[model samples]
Target: MIASPSTALVTWVLLTTPAVEQPALGTCSMGIQHLEVPPVPREKLALVCISPGQTTVINFDADLAMDSMTLDGAERFTKVEFGASTVKLIPSEKLRPGDHLRLTVRFKDTAAPSSVTLLLGVHVAQAVPFVSVLRETRTVESYQQELKTKNEELQKCIEENTRLQVESTGPGGLAELFMLGLLSDDGISSKLLHKNFVEAPTNALSATGLVSYRAANRAALMLMLANKAGMAPWTAESATLTREGKNGMGLRVLTVWQPRPIENSAEDSILVVEVKAPDDLQGSYTLKLWEAGGARTVTLHGVTFPAP
Candidate 1:
């Protein structure tokens, strides 16, 4: 009864050769691993890969993610595009000579969940032609700024000239001149009148020609004197005439005056008139007169004279 037990046994066999490991999938080699394109004129570069069938994903450095690259603070590229095993780098704009570009590339194996990352560097060189272009651009900009400044100055000058013209030709301009002792009815007497009416006449007057003076009358007298002196279209400086109170003699007028000569040429000229007023008729007056050396004859209209 004790010897009735049964047992089962298993046998094993040994092999002499070892098993070989399978190769990894999605292995890639770069066709255009590095880049060295002229940055100037050309803004784009194409990066190609030898393994076209494999899926490719491109990643850019954080610093290089900008719309454009910069060299010495100048923008170089505006955009970037990635394709299957190919990447296109669009430049921001034309590059200059001596500009530098630095970029980092990381190649990942998308097919495998666990893959090693391959790092690559891309560099683009600057060209001589683009340097010249940059220099020319700078020069042109500088010239443009200069021209603008000069144009502004010229415009200011033109405006000033126009203002002076208006003041000299406006209303009461001739009367003011007359009160300053710059006008008279007599030709010879008008020539001798001083700018200051206070100065006593060296010679005795035969008669007082100016009875009641008005701005219109002064203008007419100026035209007439110009005609009589054989000088057509006479002109005068603008002046401000103010009534200083009447004395024992007549109405007193005050103005600071300077004598100018009338010329026969078409060029604008100031006619110097010398005349005498009463002793008390002199003081500072508000008047502005411009020397019309090269200006045209100013038309007389819409002038307002001060109340006497």
Candidate 2:
């Protein structure tokens, strides 16, 4: 004989609900979830909520090896697709609510916590649609790796700074310019600007007496700026030169120079910016300068340097 609707509902609920007991080592939740793989492996299993016939996608930050996956009760899953960094699976209707299946995978890399294991628990009323798993916990090996990377980057920066300082210490004038590749056969081409070339949205500083110079692939700009917002002294900290438009290029800024800070007592200060281009640097570029504390900024659009 067929069972009544109420009886079937009760049976389904009973089958899906876990027996009242102590909580497991790992936590499980419904909806989207984010988890971190532990730096040290333990006997506790990470748990994830799943519903029958619903697909749960799990994403990993690192690449996964295809052959390294080991799923318990794999035959009970209706669908399972594994990719390089993702796994999607739908539990079969035969899986009871209290049933827990294990899924384990190994990463392709040699990082610590190289493998992860998850316990997929069937729930009565809830299922996790997506789960993002990250291996952010740093182990001793990971700390050593990070230190090695940082040391390499620092060495590169030190070498570059040393080279720049050596070039800058030479005698001033034509020899200095030649040493830095700022001189060409056409000499230093210069253009004077008397009118306002400062673009809008830069009212914190008023720029005047602007001039642009070009030599080979190098460009320079000299301008006098007065801080209208006299809250703090303005000192140039950084500068950039970018071509305007959809596919415009960005030139590397070599240096930002100023004789002194622009304060209320000293309203105006001379500012200079030098840039290096990969090729002959011509055409108009958008120049942006920022103060020491980044409280004030100035942007000059259509900054055209004289032809070589």
Candidate 3:
């Protein structure tokens, strides 16, 4: 026969040996959701999460065992306790901009072959003024270097100008000046030559102009003029002069000149110079002119005139 519920429970309890109460096996999972170390100025960081139970014991990995953990006021700790569901880290010193914290956390009874690692990077919220100042200093230095280079170039140009001015005032200066002036863009001197001398339209006789010589030392003046006019490329053929008559303190002379052939023309050109010189002069007072490359006049004085 079936007994009542209370009677059956009592009988079952009496017949079976008394079973002891056992504690439930608990579990925990720990991780970090965000790895940023907050800029709270010496505040503790809740960087680790422990779910469902209080951690009875905590340990660090072998590599981080000695001095890896630090507290806000305490230097280092191997084991720390948290009665709550989360673990908080305290720093021994206030965190500055760009500071980094690295550590490993091994949870008790966690099903894993290795522990979790934590890397906390800290950055200041405000702008750093020193960075701007450094950039401006570099820019100023670059500008100063550029200015120094420009000053050096300007000094070189000034020196060159001075040297040319000195050369223009020397011995054959007048003759050189006259030749350069003929080539000048104003065309005043060329027009004057065209007006005074008989025009010969030939490739060799490109252009002609006249100059006056006062002494018998015509060779020196001719060499100086050649050097000043940069006429090293042309060859001088001959120079011939005919005496006209006495004029003032010197004899009137006419010079017939020829030079080597120039480019763009098959034949060479002839030049003429009319000058007056003292009768006692030993050397011939003849001036020769020719057009070389780029229509520049090449001159040689005291050269022998070629046969007609």
Highest lDDT, which number? 2
Q: Each candidate: RMSD to true structure?
A: 44.9, 25.3, 49.0
Q: TM-score for all predictions?
A: 0.15, 0.48, 0.17
Evaluated against the true structure, the overall lDDT of model 3 is 0.29
On residues 134-223, what C-alpha lDDT tens digit does candidate 2 reach at each position? 796534654565567567757856855764675556565556556756557876666775554657473467775677766666666777
Off by over 4 Å in 2: 1-159, 265-267
Model 3 Cα lDDT, one tens digit per residue, 103-194: 44433432332234343433221111111101112345445655675677578557546634644553343344343231123211111112
As for TM-score, the candidate ahead, 1 or 2, is 2
Error of 3 at 131 (Å): 99
The prediction achieving the highest TM-score against the true structure is 2
Task: Please list the C-alpha lDDT of all candidates, in the order they appear.
Answer: 0.26, 0.67, 0.29
Q: Which candidate, 1 or 3, has the higher TM-score?
A: 3
Q: Which stretches of candidate 3 lie over 4 Å from their true place?
A: 1-194, 201-203, 216-234, 244-276, 280-308
Tens digit per residue, CA lDDT, model 1, 8-79? 100000001111111111212211122222223233433222110122234321122223322232244444
